[model samples]
Target: MRLRLSALATRPWLVALLIGLAAQALFAFHLDRPGGIMFDEVHYVPAAKALIELSGPRNIEHPLLGKELIALGMDLLGDNPFGWRLVPSLAGTATVLGVFTFLMVLMRGRMRVAVTGAALAMLNQSLFVQARTAMLDIFLGAFLLWGLVFLLWAMRGTRGQVLWRWCVGAALLGLATAVKWAAAPYIALVALAFVAIRLRDARRAHRPLAAALLSGDQPHWPGLPSLAGLALLGAISISVYFATFTPTFFYLTGATDGLSGLLHLQREMYAAQVQVLPHHNYQSDWWSWPLILRPIWFFYAWDHGAQRGVLLIGNPVIMWGGLVAVLVAYAVSFRGRALRPLALALLWTFSVAIYAIIPKSLGFYYYYHLSAIFLCLVLPVTFDHFDRTRDRGWEEWYVALALVCFGYFYPILSAAPLDGPMAFAHWTWFPGWR
Candidate 1:
């Protein structure tokens, strides 16, 4: 039994995952801190509380899965700050695990680089800030990150592996979408990427294009699904998404009209989302995201004679360095002509378009988390191909710089007691960040 436990402990990604989980717990779970209602907690926590009572949900603009998870945490831990914030904190840890394993896969078991990637992801202000709050985006972001990773694995897997991964990925994608419609772009991207991979594979075979796709590549793709089988995966996703709203089915809210209310509720939510709000202190244009400008202020308080604030900013090193790494990835992929790297570049480009076209009047720094997750994939994956000494030097600087940025910005991200309002404001190096 001891030997078995020791063997299990040595499995890949376990140490990295434990480190991430522990670190996230430290940052998030507070017995007596950030102890009152937070920015969006005002919306999500109460909805979750109402969910526990079988009362009507207060917010219908977003879906039920995230609130249900919050309710579950509240049930397990009671309705307090730690209780309400619990699931998101775990989701944040899961996201760190996702990033770790994702880089592990791409780098072919280079554990150190993968761990560094996870550290970068963990320290990023967007994840850190969202993890500590009861909010929708972290849940959405975590699901999408894992779902995207699973989709990539499914696409690359052989035989029964492909089928199982796709099935799991579909369900995860569904869960991601259920948390918020913001994940729709990722869902669509993964679906398109799946189809594209199959279509490309079909060209190598002499079979009919549709049949080749449905049948999957063999010898190379034994035991993979047919068209009907793929449809089943999609159905599983739809079912999971619908099932998350089971509570809604039992109790009608302003969003849900009745048994046939799902469609009406969806339309109403879409309408609400698209309407413009011209005035907000921190709203940003899409152009600013690449530069990490204009972080949205999510919360502020003057309690017990101390000032506090929560800002959705990205770590400068990760955001700015990752941007440079993206261009490098594009160059390396184009020059090396690597299939996966090329796909990563295309996905990043695609995300920029998706971000630009969103109809919301406000886009904020936090929305860039999706781009950041994808960019996280680029650095480690590219770093693996670099010469040994240079790779070491680069990663050393990357980790040190990212950690320094995290330290500099922690007061603002966590709402730690400040000397005054401007104490946190002083951390903003750029005029635009203010």
Candidate 2:
């Protein structure tokens, strides 16, 4: 029994499975409650149903993959609340597993760090809210994380396996872009990072740079992809993104039957997305996102004879503490103390920085979802750093505090029954939150 238990404990797949199941259960619980469309469901759910009937178009500013998946759920389960939300819940669960896989690879198979990161990701308030609602960000997040996961896997794969791994990573990222254009920056980041690393490796190995570029060899990390491989990966991603639009060609109202139509649709999407719009009450700046300056209230009303609300906010402990963790990680990296944490910090920064360059004039707190999820990586890395420095209890205390905050905010985060009409006051610690 002891040996069997030990074996079970060491199996990362089993552990990841458990984590994914727990996340799904949480996202699915009371998912059918509120008994009606909440927030953007009014946009995507109808859009999804319309796609199924091929009657008209809706929500044209975004890509089709997310709505297609939502439509699949509704078609299979009946066009009800459960059907509308089930896919996003599953995507949220996939995001948890992606976090686990990503950290596992980044940390060199340290199960503890991976599991801790996944747990924090599962508890992130934004993830919880987006997972329960029919939204595109969670889909974007799941694909984005898995894309990075595959890229990390490519770094460690054998020579014959690396190319295929890169392709898979690029494909997933392409799917992410198909879900939303926000994912496009990540692809650029990946391509640029690969080019830089490949060039660095060639210089270090004393190889002729031009020769190495054509041959696709790396001295430091053997099997690292070459420029040619990167191009192929980009092509694969673009193909995937284009393929997602195939269904749109058949849509009765917004059909795009050829390449010219596809180009026209792209122009329409760009016009709709970037056009300046009236300010939203919950609109926030990118800089203030990590600070949790504002949160979007997806739902607030009397349900089952009590007040309930759903607030798209990050867990305070994780958000605030993760910010500190990123700073500390950067400091340590500058002093030559660590390299991996530094990479996480850079990725976290880039995720938020993409929003700054995008042409969109309006932003919401929920746009910070990617940044909040990346904090899961920073948190575990910080815990590992503390453990190495003889600060053994920080991880435990961090997890405990995170769980406590999650419970305190559970009522608002999950649209659970509140104490009274003013129950929101309990969680609204700051005036801005109101």
Candidate 3:
């Protein structure tokens, strides 16, 4: 009865929207805390400031769209900690809304579980920490999630709406890639998903693979407009990508020789990203991230009477528990051949691919940020299944556990100064974390 009431919110969309705003509020509220640049803020905040002052290229390894967005925030909010980080915090909140909307769209009539997923995303330690800082990853990730949602919506649209939705999705991704090339893989994954969905639909309808390729299958997937739609989507995506570089195009003209300057600049950025580097203090392999075994220390402070440390890491409750949930889902999902399970598997696989393939040596702990959110998304599936089947306990317990951890870790994550050395030491449960 309580479960049904929970689902009976008068307008679930509004509830999700409010949750998004609340999430944003939570991230935005502490902008001025533990004052000064933290972590990658040292790099991005300066670049953002440079863009505002029209200073020359800085943080040249990445494109300037993200910095430009940050500059806009600084322009309005003032050039302090709050101002530099303002847009990233808001983008993080908007990401929560996007995730909620996507889950609602993905799972028909399953508002409760969708909300559960978004809420988990809100609290995941790594995601929450990443969102709070002035970093490119959060901005890149927020737009990627939104674009994927819109792309899925396009797949569900009529011919008339399909083109428009697809174009919009492409445009968002174009901007996302401009923020950080890390989003390039997401764009590729979506194109790949379009083909996979069409193929899967044809096979489900018992059409011969060869014949379908030759002439297309009967009763096409409601989720997919057509195979030719793939071509159209790709073309629009490329055009949108080029469109995002307009600022870069002109910015380059001033900073370099000509159109050749643009090409040369891109090559330099690419070279920097792939260049090998020696071990650093915060560098941790992707394998350790899932276990919460390694974390980046963003800042440490000692005042006349206060001491505080800002550690970048995941919440053990979600990281460890979510890992178990995914293993359970993987084992059970294949046994039934269900669409929900299959979709879950594909989405999980994509996020994993993004992290797993990254070089283990140069990997920063934050590289695992998206994977942590993916696990959070996967973490709830097992619990949602239990609720639907009257096989319960996991959902309630998991939520309880997550809430407890959220408060327990709030001090360090928010950059609150510690009461004493002992208090700070207590938060580090593992030697590697210290």
Candidate of highest TM-score: 2
lDDT measured at residue 7 in model 1 versus the true structure, 0 to 100: 59
Candidate 2 lDDT tens digits, 105-159: 8877777677789889988989999999988999999999999999878877778
Local distance difference test scores for all models: 0.74, 0.86, 0.74
Worst 10 residues of 2 by lDDT: 1-10
Instruction: Estimate the TM-score for candidate 3.
Output: 0.91
Query: lDDT: which is higher, 2 or 3?
Result: 2
Best by lDDT: 2
**TM-score of every candidate:** 0.90, 0.95, 0.91
- How far off is residue 283 in model 2, in Å? 1.0
Number of residue pairs clashing in candidate 2, backbone atoms closer than 3 angstroms, sequence gap of 3 or more or interchain: 0
Which regions of candidate 3 deviate over 4 angstroms? 1-10, 206-227, 249-258, 303-305, 358-361, 389-393
Q: Residue 244 CA error for candidate 1 (Å)? A: 1.2
Error of 2 at 186 (Å): 0.5
Quote the positional error of residue 364 for candidate 1 in Å: 2.3
lDDT of 3 by residue, 1-434 (tens): 33653656557867876797789888877677657887788998888877776657788888878888888889998888788888888888877777777777666546666677787888877777877788888888788878877887766666566667777887788778888877888878877766676667668877666544444333332323455556666677666655554555445325655668777878888887877878788777767777777798787786334676678888888888877877777777777744565466567666666766754338777877777767766766667765776746566567678879988998888787788766768788888888
Clashing pairs in 3: none
